[model samples]
Target: MTTILLLASLATLGYAAWYLILCSVSPWERCRRCHGARSHRTAIGTRRDCPRCDGTGIRVRIGRRLLDYIRTEYRAGSQ
Candidate 1:
């Protein structure tokens, strides 16, 4: 039981570290809706910019957004 708990905790820690590094290195990821094409095709074959990413083809990672929010909150609290 203890071994399983230790392993789970270690896995969680490793994933967190990896995600932090990822957010630091590449905070943006391809938009799921546009698949990095920046636009989507309508049923009639017309193309429109992706609404989610605003045609940027990428969006900020959730982890990075969370980090930014936390940093902003900390700064506001400190001041």
Candidate 2:
């Protein structure tokens, strides 16, 4: 039925939003915890191509944009 389809679509959308939130923690944040361990990869986030590393995944992101996006989602979720 159309009603059932609508509910399923809504559920899928909710799950996608949740997945994005869970993957916003980039590896750069972890480096702050342990000295000389900046090579760690993000456990839940993506590591896209970096010009400096030539896709070797050793480069750092310019800013903490991932954390910013996560904070925005958190605020929306709380409201």
TM-score: which candidate is best?
1
Show where candidate 2 strays beyond 4 Å: 26-79
Taking all chains together, each candidate's TM-score versus the true structure is: 0.93, 0.32
Candidate 2 similarity to native, TM-score = 0.32
Candidate that scores best on lDDT: 1
What number of clashing residue pairs does each candidate have, in the order they appear?
0, 0
Tens-place lDDT per residue, model 2, 1-79, is 9999999999999987665565454534232322233333456774434333444434343344566677899999999
Clashes of 2: 0
**What's the distance in Å from true for residue 37, model 1?**
0.3
